[model samples]
Target: MPFIVHVLGFATFAQGTSEFMLSGLLPALAADLDVSLSEAGLLVSAFAVGMVIGAPLLTLATLGLPRRAALVGFQAVFVAGHAAAALVPHFGFLLAMRAVTGMAYAGFWALASVTAVSLVSADRRGKAMSVVVAGLSLSMILGVPAGTLLAQHADWRAAFWAVAATTALSATAVLLALPAGRDTTAARPGLRTELRSLAVPRLWRAYATTALTISATSAVFSYLGALLEDVTGIPERLVPVVLGLYGAGALAGLIVGGRTGDRAPFGVLLTGMGTVAVVAAALAPTAEIPAVVIPLVVLLAAGGFATNPAVNARVFGILGETRTLGGAMNIAAFNVGIAVAPWVSGLAIDAGPGPAGIGWVGAAFALAALANTLLDRHLTHRHRRTTSRSAPTAVDGARATTVSLYAGHDRPL
Candidate 1:
């Protein structure tokens, strides 16, 4: 509803483009730097590590500054990091630049949702947040492929330069668009309060749910290309086309999640996770069938990302006043899942199961998350009913008053 929403989305697109394009450019980077492929791959891990720690630590370090200022500052650093990567001569320096970019990106992610929600009414928070996330989906569909094409046609360094330039534009746009003021509404908690906020046990459950739900699907997705080629009997040339289908499904899921999340967050989460688990189960059995497996891949991607809006909305609901900290923690949780799940799946593949077994592993993760969600729902309902029964009611007060005025009230109307 607000123009600022698009501004934030543009910034998110710039960041997402920078993040996802690395995979496409990795080969060129490895060749140019005279490094092994594995070493180049570690650069991705290094970026994840930065996000895993930087999101919260940076938020804590800059807790008192106005959110808009923090946003602009982070984007500036992000632009600088990419520019350094573009110009750096050595592999190690480029790796350091990637880490810096990741840290800045994570800090911006941690605050951007909060800022978007702040700009709109409470009811539209999910919708606004989803638009921000769609930037990533669009990156997966367009930016990564385009960057790969650029690298193929010209040089990998050109991709980095393009991202750096885009980020600079986004930083300037954010500076001009968002209101320049401190968040006067949310109380800025002290260090101790922030620590206590992190201590909430229920919040961790929500985080676990978010992480596990993402891992369930990402495990399968991370290896979709290999699986399609080896297990599904699909030709190597068609893998990208199939992957594009998955991306489209993800976009659809994001749209559906955005619309329903504000109305029924838990319901949306349960449905999405359950659907993912079911699709994963179906995948293992039909891995050899191209027609079935192809459709299942789409469904799996949709099911996986469909949980995004609900996961975010539910965490914010649980954290209340500490949403900034909670949002940062949740983003960290998702990145942790992204970093861990694929490795675990690879272990499963090596243990005896073939490529097809990855789907089963994902199914197990989804089921575990589903069980946790059901448990949370049960506990919430039981607590509410218990509180209702024990609460002081109007009838109790009426009874107490009757005793005080019994003689006078003997004659009823």
Candidate 2:
């Protein structure tokens, strides 16, 4: 509801554009850098590696600083990284720049969600988080395509230049609009206390759920182009249209999920994961039918992403005082899924059933995540019952908090 929250959302939009724009420019980048396609592909991996490492590390390092300052600083570095990436003559230098860019993005990514939610009340946390998260889905639907068009119409370097400019603009906006405030009180915990906060098994369950859910979604999407052409008999030209529909579905899902998540965290997550598994399994049998498969693709995106806000809110609710570390860890888990899912699916494709079978692989992952979600619920309930029998500390109260999606209501959220 705050103007600053929207500013943070804009920052996320800029960051998400940079994160996904590279996917569309790899071919042009490969040609310009005089490298093979596979080599150019490594840049994506490089970014993921940086995100996984930078998220928690940078989040922790910045804990004592003002939230507004950290945000502006991160975006400034992100802009510089893209600008450097655009000017680098060699592929290695560009790769290094992208890694740095990823680190900057991770810092902003972790903090922005927290900053957004911090401005809202407990009942509205999911909605606030959703505003920030929607920037990512919007990037997939809009920014990536625009970047691809820029690369095709101009040079790939032009795309990077545009990204850098956009990031700089976002940084300026954040600097001008975001208020300077420490995210926490004067008694900031030491690094050891922060590390101890992450030791909660319930938090790890949330992390695992995030990782596995992302892995499922990424596995299917990473090979979607191939699946569309090779298996669905759709021409290559229409793939973007189909993918665009998928993006729209994701945005819609995110909106609905955010609203539902505020009401029923675990229920929404379970339902979303179950939908993903069902859609993925159905895709395995229905890939040959474009009409059926196309809708399924949209459903897949919707189902997979609907869990984002809920899972994020759950982590925030459970972490309580440790929210910063918890948020960073969750972001890292997302990147872990992004990095791991495609690799696992690639292995599956290379081993046997070809590209179409990626659906089954994705389905298996969704099912596994569904199982994990069940475990998380069971643990939450068990912890709640245990804590009620004895005096509970702050951390124990947080751990025992009910994160159930439906709570007690059988009616829809």
> Would you list the C-alpha lDDT of every candidate in the order shown?
0.75, 0.78
- Backbone clashes in model 2, listed as residue pairs: 264-405, 265-405, 266-405, 267-405
| Ten-residue stretch with the least lDDT total in model 1 | 404-413
Best by lDDT: 2
Clashes found in each candidate (C-alpha, N, C closer than 3 A): 0, 4
Name model 2 segments beyond 4 Å from true: 26-41, 89-91, 181-192, 226-237, 284-289, 352-354, 391-413
Clashes of 2: 4
Candidate 1, residue 206: the lDDT equals 75
CA lDDT of 297 in candidate 1?
Answer: 84
Question: Model 1, range 127-182, lDDT digits (tens) per residue?
Answer: 88888888877776676666666776787888888887888888888878866663
TM-scores of all candidate predictions against the true structure: 0.83, 0.87
Alpha-carbon RMSD of each model: 7.8, 4.0
Question: In candidate 1, which residue ranges exceed 4 Å CA deviation?
Answer: 22-43, 86-96, 179-187, 225-241, 284-290, 349-357, 394-413
Tens-digit lDDT track of model 2 for 1-413? 98878887777877887776665566577788898544665677677778888899999999888877888898888888888777775899988887888888989988887777767887788889888988888877877767766777788888788888888888888877865553443445667787887877778888898999888887787667567767889864566577677778889999999989867878888899999999999998888899999999899999988999888877777666557777899899888887777667767767777777889989999999999988877767665566545535766555434433222111233
